[model samples]
Structures are given as structure tokens and as C-alpha cells.
Target: MSKAEIQTTGFFTEREFTCWRERDYKNFYPCQVSKQEGNYVSLSLGDMSYRFDDTIAEDIARCILDADLVTAGKLYGYIPKPAMRESAFDSWYKMNSSGVWNYFGEGEFSYYRSGGVIIFMERVTDEDDTAEIMGIYTIDDVGIKLVLESSSYSFSKLDAVWLSNALMEALGEEPLDFLKTSTM
Candidate 1:
């Protein structure tokens, strides 16, 4: 069985949105990388989705800064509301909170979703990228799950495609067909 690792303790990827509700603050919802062009990006977070397109800015999309997350040019998809799931730790808010409210450090949380997602993207061997270990998870006060391929995840076909693309994004290179999955 594979083991899961804790990449963070809180929701690091979630940004404060004007359309967010109270309950939608905690926990991380799985997201699919629907699209990722030069200056355009899109993600499907089940109940809701996010898209960024800086037509005026070229390669600056990847140069996403903290301030850009909230003030950047964004487009809310799927119902214009955040998915329902209260977060135990709102790292985004906490990290940005006043010195008194900055309870958690930035690395303590993840920004990938599910509080923040921990993506296992290690090359199996140092020789090449042919064999690799890959997994996605969330770790918070709930405890940590650290292992490789220890759990089974059911993914949709579209999800598989997008996740593969996401893995590539994680690697900062070409996407790979690493995640073998089944349709939901």
C-alpha cells in the first residue's frame, strides 16, 4: 500500500472571495485543472469554480502574488458561490490577519484545496522521470496520512485528464499520465 504525506495543516489554497459563505471557509474541496494556458487558468471545484485571465499581462500569470489572489482579475464559475464546507483553519485569513490574528504560518497550510492539498510528485528514481510517485491529500488538525499509493481514489475520466495536467503543473513541466483512475 502507498502512504500519504502531510503537506500542510490548513486550507492554504483557498482565497477570500466576496461570494464566500461562513461554512465555505473550512476544509478543502477537490479541484480539477480544467484549463491552463499562458495567461489563462481555470479550475473546477465541484460546486464552484475559478478562472483567471490576464489579457493585459502575458507570462505574469504564474507570477501570482498574495495580493493578486484577492485583487487579481478573476471570474467565478458554477453558481457564483463557494462550495459548502467549513474550514477548521482559514490559513488565508489567518496568514493575512493582523499580527495578533496571524495564528498560523503560511507553510502550515496548503493552497491546493481540502484546507490545502499535499501533492506527492516525486520521481521514483533519480535517473529519470519515467517512474514517479504521485498522490493528493489534505492534512490539518485531523492528523496526517503519509505514504505512497496507500489509498485508492476513484476519479472521473475528465478528472483523470485534468489531474494529469495538474500533475504536470505541479512538476512545472509537461503533464504526465501518472494517475490511473476509474470513472465515478
Candidate 2:
């Protein structure tokens, strides 16, 4: 067995390079962002040598465009923030470690379609060792649930995997796996 080397090259700023390195899991993930002819940007993720398909690359580009549009308040319904997990965990931690002693425990989350409504289901354990299931209703029925696996504050690999899968399923396509392994 051998360890993979990590390196980056391109017209990337320090902040952009840092963000890309943080998102790299195996210590070697290449992130390329190029400006296209129009109001579009081209992005790629993986080892520098890996050749991504044009269609998949286009999908990535489109996802970026849609996200920019959504963030600019031009799109409606569920326009998920790129750092949703981070945001979620931040709120979770804040609620857990406030002026009082409340721990955000863990449980399961499931989502599906029913009656033309998009619903979010969550089960979380509180400080008192009690589990509660909560439901979230959204304007658009995306038919996906964002589940919080554990509330122990120490996030696990399984939690990360599940969240990744859930979010990809919701996004209709596998997004560029760009996230750092950090709480909040």
C-alpha cells in the first residue's frame, strides 16, 4: 500500500485553495474553477489526473449556477445552502451548550412523499435521555429527509455517510463532495 500525495495548481486564491484543501478528504483532491464564455463557471473535483466526464462536469456547473441563482433570491422553494450541515451542527451545538445544560442527543430521520407535501422527519435525544420525533414541512415536496444521527457532539463516520447520501438524493444528483471534516 502507498499514501497518495496532495498537490494543487491553477489560478486559485489563498482562500480558495484553503477551502479546496479543507474539502479534500484523502489529502489529495483537485478543485478547478474556470470562467466559461458566458455567465458560467466550470468546476472539477478529484485527483488532478482523473478526467471527469463532460456531462457530469456540466451537471456540476449547472448546480453551481442554480445555487448562485437561488442564493441571489431568484429561485424559490428549497434552495439548500452549500454548508447546510455546518449550519445545522452550529445550531445544534448552540442549543446544546447555552446558558443551561441541554445536550443535543441523536436518533434517526426519514423522508418521503405524501399528499403532495415535502415533509422532514427527525428523532433526537435530549439531555433527559428522552427521544422525540419532529416533523418539518416545506413548501416544495422534494421527498427527502435530513436526519441527524447522533447528538453526542462527536460526529461519526456513519453520520457523515448517511448525511451525504441523504443530501445527494435530495439534490437529484451527486454534488461535488466539497466539505471539511469539522463540527459546525
Candidate 3:
């Protein structure tokens, strides 16, 4: 067994140990890694001890580090309310108050709100009529603003993805495969 030490920063300083196996399993197991203080590393399928070479260990460590950074940055993968515009709030409020604007254009549409973030999804009547995420908006003291627009990469899609997952979890529905209609 090979072992390596990993150092991480932010919030606090910590040391992590990675015990590696000589053989490669072709896939990283225990798919989900834990963040329980000292238990920061994930193990492969065959061992109780987290085993991986420095390369794999570093990869896992990077993921853990990134997650920590996201948390530190207060970016838990969703639009923050302070980032929303008044127009978006009005639109959302109108839809919710009357419950009559659920359908728009050629397909059905719905919106989900959590914290300060709002996600809009639509099922277009075009060729690929699947329900696709349209945009992610945020509301704050400054009003509402579009945080993630489906057609461009100017914004982080991770927040939108997080919102979508949250929606699915709340509705007890299967994961939805949102179509990317952006021609760009």
C-alpha cells in the first residue's frame, strides 16, 4: 500500500491521508465522498481504506477543495436573491398569484423558487418538445436579474443544474434531461 499526505486551505488547515492500491479498478468507487471533518477522502470499490495513487488522490482532493471553495464563496449552486431584477419578480408573482400563465408560446412552462433563486423551465412545442430549463434569476435589494440564460455560457450553469435537481427532489419526480436549444 502506498500513502500520501494532502494539505488543504480555507476555513481551517487540515491534513488528509490517501492509501493507494497497486492495481487499478478502472473506476472510482464509493462514488460519493464525505466531508466529515477527518473523513474527507473516498475509497475505491475493493477496500475499506481509501486507496488511490497520488494522481487519483489529488483529483479527489481537488473536488473536495472546489466544493469547499464554493461553500466559502456562498455559491451553493443557485442564483442568490440579491442578484434578481424587479421584472423577474413581477413575472413570477403574477404567475403565482393568478395561476393562469403556466403555459406560454407553444408548450407548458413552470417556475420554481428556493431562497433568493428562481428557475424557469419550459416544454416547447418545437421539434424537441422536452421540458428544458430556460433561465435562472435572482432577487435581491437591487431587484431581479437573469443569472443563467440557456443560450450562452457567460454564466455558470452549475447553479441552474443545482436548482433543477432541487426541483426534482421537491416534486418527487425523475431526473429531467433538459434540451439545450442554444444555436450558439
Candidate 4:
């Protein structure tokens, strides 16, 4: 009935509590992060959390045993910068009246998967129509294709779920209920 409330802990009470974030305000959804005993950092989206180890490799772990531990932007690729989105409507809305056209148009995104299966999305709106649009594609040996549903993949169900959750968060879509997937 109401907006969902985010949970926090004494470990996350400070403004310094958030995970890696994009500098722009409208850039990305701010998923929460957690760490304990300096072992790993978990970037969580709803019930799905991706664990990234914070410790160095065992081969070099002993080299910094006595040094003061610090968080020197240690979380980068593990928590990437949110994908940026832009639209022609944004430019026109900016160039036109600000009062009545404040929220006049909807996004028209172009979603495509790269050769490596990495997804990329871009806004290509051309009108002020309040029509929302998006596309979903499956990447396979045949390359990108519009499929009804994506079920099978070369990766595990757990990785699939994590990627789904991350993309949803990045695109500002609702997080699906398939949160707990087995690592099998």
C-alpha cells in the first residue's frame, strides 16, 4: 500500500553508509552495502546480494597484515558506476517551458546486448508523448534476439538472478520476487 522502507543497521547509520554510487543524482538506484570482519562487501538489491571479497589474494594477504586497513575506493568493478540514461525529451523539456512540461514525456529506451552478452540501454525519445517503452533481449550464440522469456543460460541461476536484480535496479524497475536462487 505504501512505499517500501529500506532497512539499516548501526553498521549503516552514517552518511558514509552507502555503497559505490554515481555522482549524478538521477543516475542510479542506491543499493545498500554491508561488510563485517573486513572479509567482504555485499552489494544488496532487495533480497539479492552480490558478495565481493575485500581481502587481497592469499599470496599477498600477509604483506599488509600490520598496516591500518582502509576503504580506498576498494569497491569499483564489483559495484560498477550505474549506466547513464538520456533522452531527446529531456533536451526539449529543458529548452521549453518549465512549468507545464515539468513531467510531460516518458522514456523511450533502446536496449541491446553486446557481442559479449553485456547489456546496454539508451534513451532515444523523439516526442513529448507520455508513452513509456523498453525492450528485453536474450543473448545467445546466434547473438541478440527478442525472446518471450529468458530461462536458460550458460551461467548459474544465481548469477542470472544477480544480473537481473542489478539491471532492474539500474533501470529503476521493480525488483522481482526471484530473490533467493540456489548456487547450484
- By TM-score, who's the top model here? 1
What does candidate 1's lDDT look like per residue over 53-110, in tens digits? 3221111111112112222112121111223333221223232232221111011111
TM-score of 2: 0.21
Candidate 3 positional error at 9, Å:
26
All candidates: TM-score: 0.23, 0.21, 0.19, 0.20
Error of 1 at 162 (Å): 5.8
Quote model 3's TM-score: 0.19
lDDT score for candidate 2 against the true structure: 0.27
Query: Where does model 1 exceed 4 Å of error?
Result: 1-32, 36-38, 52-137, 140-164, 167-173
Please estimate how well model 4 matches the true structure, expressed as its whole-model Cα lDDT: 0.26
Tens-place lDDT digits, model 2, residues 29-55 = 233333223322222333221121233
Query: Which pairs, if any, clash in model 4?
Result: none
lDDT of 3 by residue, 1-184 (tens): 1222221321111122111121133222221122223312232222222322223233222222222223223333332222222221122221325222221111133434344333333333465543333332322211112222233111122322332332332233442324341212
lDDT of 4 at 106: 24
Residue-level error in angstroms, candidate 3, position 65 = 0.7
Summed backbone clashes in each candidate are 19, 1, 12, 0
* Regions of candidate 4 where Cα sits further than 4 Å from its true position: 1-122, 127-135, 138-157, 168-174
